[model samples]
Target chain A: MQKQVEIIKANGEREFFDEGKLRASLLRAGAEDSQVEAVLRHISKELEDGMTTDHIYRHAFSVLKDVQNPRAIRRYSLRRALIDLGPTGFPFERFLAKLFASQGFEVKNDQILQGRCVPHEVDLVAYNENKLVMVESKFHNRMGEKSDVKVALYVKARFDDLSEQLFDYGKARPLDEGWLVTNTKFTENAIKFGVCAGLKMVGWNYPEKGSMRDLIEDSRLHPVTCLPSLTKEERELLLNNDMVLCSQILDSQSKLIELGIKREKVTTIAAEAEALCGR
Target chain B: MQKQVEIIKANGEREFFDEGKLRASLLRAGAEDSQVEAVLRHISKELEDGMTTDHIYRHAFSVLKDVQNPRAIRRYSLRRALIDLGPTGFPFERFLAKLFASQGFEVKNDQILQGRCVPHEVDLVAYNENKLVMVESKFHNRMGEKSDVKVALYVKARFDDLSEQLFDYGKARPLDEGWLVTNTKFTENAIKFGVCAGLKMVGWNYPEKGSMRDLIEDSRLHPVTCLPSLTKEERELLLNNDMVLCSQILDSQSKLIELGIKREKVTTIAAEAEALCGR
Candidate 1:
């Protein structure tokens, strides 16, 4: 058992907690950055004295929930809380993706494409020897009347984007199947709509529920880390490095554009190189 | 001391003491809601056993950055992370308002004027026995060449909106003052412009760091809380009660309108009652 830590609040009260697990969970969720350290320092400075682990978690999560990219950290923090309490439909799609990946499917998370106008970022795309599957995940407590329509739209959007056949990877092919993964059971109308649209629907059913843990164990995914644990100097270094890399990439791209090299050709060469390098 | 916890990765090895704190810090700032919880759960379920916390925080915050809201939760989350480690300009206005309130000044945070065309939401409006102050806070890593022009524009916007006639509170007369706070040291031109515009400028001069905190503490302004913290049942109860009250008020007003009642007379009565009730 991990020893509990106490946080002192502004009013001279002490809040005790077994925060090691929470901290570990945050680190696993990918929060390593200077900003995280700064936030923790602020918490320490603002301490009046007595604050509970739950209070800290709630406050921290609340603050972070408003951040630009909160999905991973929020999920990690919530999982820690749920594991200690009771589960909710928090990590519904992520859980399903892990389960599917464990069963020997190659999972590509957050695949981005340059859409006709804005960038189209898909949640998860899985490919195997037999087929390519595009999935849209939903973690709602309840699906309303329009939920199925929304899912159908998402499936259609993915299919349309994939059908463009832009990427030259072993003769670009159309999407083999579309899947909708929802935490709650779909409405009858949704199931019918999904079937009509030629999309597969997977609700979190009982048999799948029993095998969830095993599936998670089998699928080899990475853990996310929190950002607060870094020192000031370390954060500056990382930020500087990122800025440098971004600048370099931009500089290279600009040079290529200046040389009158067509963007499509450049992209093709880059993609081929990346594929050969196994990136 | 809190005991360190380790996460077991896919390779059956433990990754120890990963220090990703940015996400945790942002969470500490504010990200507490059911939607955030749902998103986090999705990310966690998709995780591989060995992933680092940095990856998770980056991915999560990135997703949240795209959400649309007047309060700019993404910016606030980033500001919190920055403040937790130390102080930044982004949250300077709110921080200062809190400090002023702690010092016995009556402070109003995010005062929204619905009558206005664009619904001007002032960052902080503060009053004391001798002073009525309007403050604008700016967060910048560096003082740009156009810094002075930006400040001038902000001051002009506020001045234009304010009613010229001094607010009369019976025997109490209003005293006017305007202030601008910034993270970086202001440019010489900016300082000159502020002086010309009749605005006092305060820059975070390192030794005076405590001054800002003091101002916030003195202001005693409370942090804003979102609506979702309460359970669905609680929210529904409050909402239903509010709807009933609004309906009653509307019905009474409509009846008065139908009975040859002048709009001015009805307004006067309501205003009088509100004043008497201190609402």
Candidate 2:
């Protein structure tokens, strides 16, 4: 009987603690007490037997996203939520920027908008051989009709905000193309909207059999900005600093690589380190 | 947009209709409407996005097991609920009984005990060479401490309510055992009480792997009685009269097999069928 009770207590406590762990994760991600409480309450009310912790995290994130200014919460919360949603949207955007750089397109994230009402963070801005492409991403189980309208708005924003002078004067050109990427089948209305807006819609389906990651790689985006110059003494000091930083970064990268994080992402970190240290 | 909306609407409506599938399953199994409705309400309130239709059925059935005298409800309601829960439990029990037969135990289900002040049906009964096991089964996440007391009381009543002759004869022979089986773990205090009362406690975490099906297989309890016999000609006539019914049963068995339902369960069903047909 003691053994039986111990087993039961252990099982119950494990369940209770698992929920607590999720709550702690949310807190660590800087969720407000009220938001955390609300999420936990919703979860408790809806919980049935056999629910996985991952399912709870996804559900909580969805609920949080529905609330206003969810991004103001901890950076990790947003990242964890994106991860829980799988490789899409913001995560995919970051992933694409790195993949494009590795493949050779001059890629920039959070590129400055010169004429916008406010400084806006565009997902990705890629320049290759005087041609520029602006890309936006949407992740959903299935793309609805409204998605096309949303993407069209993004394209219009990009075309209106970026510098037009770059196209004719500088080696780099003003963005001439727009891309909208999604994980599910797009509605016909969305397809027509994309065509009318002069934006390419990349949908992952059985026939296409490609993810946003693949498209980003194919774009061949790389970093084109030149590194700052340094004198001999300054360069030597910087090189020493860079070596130390690079080793540290490499150690972390090695761990990530061992954990099966994409090699392209690790390579991007290495490139950034190399540029900093004049390697 | 219209096509996408149409598909979403269609799938949404289909899910709505299928939502009551568990109620249909219960009604088919002789459960009452009020009982099934109460269970379904508990289930519907717990629904989450991306949950499968089959999950709802299993959940409803698990909840239904806690409701006493489920078959006392209106026949229509019972049938509806059974349909909702799926038509697997009864056959599963039969298979479990057969699997345990070789181990010298006679397993019985839905056995009414009028000896007590309030008549009730036992979910399972196993008579071994040396012991008579009275078993109650509840399929859910966690059985509360009170539920443990209830099982203990039931076991005590069952033992005490036996005829004096039978009790004396059994006493002269060997001691009988009682068991309470649940999908969830028991409270520590409850286990102590059960152990003190000499009743065996079985939970989801039994047999090291927390699978209910596995526990039934490992327990080695069998059916003491066979199905009612039918002549060969009568069996043939019945099969011919309801070929669709026969096929449906076969299909259900095949589906169970596909789901990795225990082989012992399937064999029990086959044995019961053979007995029913006197084959």
Best candidate, TM-score: 1
Which ten-residue region of model 1 chain A has the weakest summed lDDT? A270-279
DockQ of 1: 0.01
- How far residue A127's Cα lies from its native spot in candidate 2, in Å, is 1.5
Q: Cα lDDT for residue A85, model 2?
A: 35
True contacts kept of 2: 0.00
**Chain A TM-score for each of the predictions:** 0.39, 0.41
**Interface alpha-carbon RMSD, every candidate:** 20.5, 31.9
In order, the TM-score of chain B in each prediction is: 0.39, 0.38
What interface-residue Cα RMSD does candidate 1 give after superposition? 20.5
lDDT of 1 by residue, A86-201 (tens): 13332344445555665678776667654332244567777777777777766554333124443544455445545554532233555677777654456565555566556677
lDDT of 2 by residue, A150-254 (tens): 344344444544535354323645667777766444555456545554567776431253444234223322111111121234223322332212234434656
Candidate 2, residue A259: CA error in Å?
8.8
CA deviation > 4 Å runs, candidate 2: A1-88, A116-119, A141-146, A161-172, A206-253, A257-279, B1-279
